[model samples]
Target: MNASLFCMAIFSVTLNAVAQIALRKTMLTLGALPSSLITAFSFLTNLIGNFWFLGGMLCYAVSIGAWMIVLSKAEVSAAYPLLSIGYLITAAIGYFFLGEHVNTTRLIGIGIICIGIVVISRSA
Candidate 1:
């Protein structure tokens, strides 16, 4: 990928990661949804009004726009794997900002993902 495309891919993945984090936080706040129809409708209303949920949706929209641009210029075989970078980004953010655990096994999985990303990028 060219510099601009590479940057766009990074931007897309970062936004995607942010979206995941935001949505996770929103869910943590909202807890489980009600099973009853009326209560479920109320829950849906509350979710739509949530700032974090709206922000997450906006991030996803922007990320998809940037991702579309990247796909136009890059091969899917090479470009799609770049989304895996979002896992690393999300895991770090979760550990640092959200007090989420990052255990040894998860760290090893993240390392493997990093290696895969490097290999895929080089292949492109």
Candidate 2:
């Protein structure tokens, strides 16, 4: 991939990762959703005021734009594997920021994902 296209992919993936982390934090604060729309709306309004929700929304907006650019330049099959980069980043953020576990098996899986991304990039 060209430099600009590669940067776009990275931005898309990073934003996606950050968004996942932010959303997870927001959900933890908000707890489970209520069945009633009114209750849900009220909770959402409160939730939106939280930093995590706003940060996630910002990241999501940026990711959408970057992803469109990436899709324009690369085939979906070639580009879709890039999403795993997001997963890896999100897993790290989840573990570090949210105090989630990162067992040996999961670490090994992440290592495999890194190898896959490297292989895919080389193929492109």
Candidate 3:
């Protein structure tokens, strides 16, 4: 891929990963959301009012636009696999920013994902 397209792909995936992390943090901040229909409605109302949650939604919209550009520049089959890069990004964010632990098995899984991405990129 050209540098511009590659950068956009990376940006798109980063936004995807970051949005998820932000949303998770937002939920954690909210704490102990209910599963019942009425309580869920109240939860949704509060969630929608939060700026961070809205920002996460906005990130998704922007990421989708970037992803479309990536699609235009590259094969969907190739571009889609690159989204796994988000898993790596999220895992790193969770580890460094959120104080989340990464076990050996998770590291190995991430390694396998990296290998698969390399294989897929070579195919393109």
Candidate 4:
């Protein structure tokens, strides 16, 4: 991919990561749900009111638009690996924002994913 396309891909990946993290943050706000249908409905109703969740959905819409741009510029097979970059981005966000742990094993796995993305980008 050229500079603009690559930048778009990175932006798409970043937006996706933000969406995923936002959804996660939204979920954390809701504690364990009751098993009753009425309680579940109430919980769902409250979830709808969250601005962050709505923003996350908007992020998803923009991410799709960016993805479409990437697809128009390159083959899906070559561009798809860029999606996995979301995992890497979200891990860091989760660590800092959510206080989630990122131990050696997770770091190693993320490293492998990074290597794969690098190889795939080179192939395109």
Candidate 2 — which residues are off by over 4 angstroms?
Answer: 35-38
lDDT, candidate 4, 33-121, per-residue tens: 66899798888887898777888999999999999999999889988998898889999999998999999999999999999999988
lDDT of 3 by residue, 1-124 (tens): 7778988999999999989988988888788888789799888888989877988899999999999999988999988998999989999999998999999999999999999999998888
lDDT of 1 at 3: 92
- Estimate TM-scores for all models: 0.96, 0.87, 0.92, 0.94
Top candidate when judged by lDDT against the true structure: 1
**TM value for model 1:** 0.96
Which stretches of model 1 miss by more than 4 angstroms? none
lDDT of 1 by residue, 39-78 (tens): 9988899899999999999999999999999999999999
Off by over 4 Å in 3: none
Order the numbered candidates by lDDT, best leading.
Answer: 1, 3, 4, 2
Measured on C-alpha atoms, candidate 2 has an lDDT of: 0.89
Tell me the deviation in Å of residue 88 in model 3. 0.7
Each model's total of backbone clashes: 0, 0, 0, 0
Report the lDDT tens digits of candidate 2 across residue range 46-71.
Answer: 89798989999999999999999999
- How would you order the candidates by TM-score, starting with the best? 1, 4, 3, 2
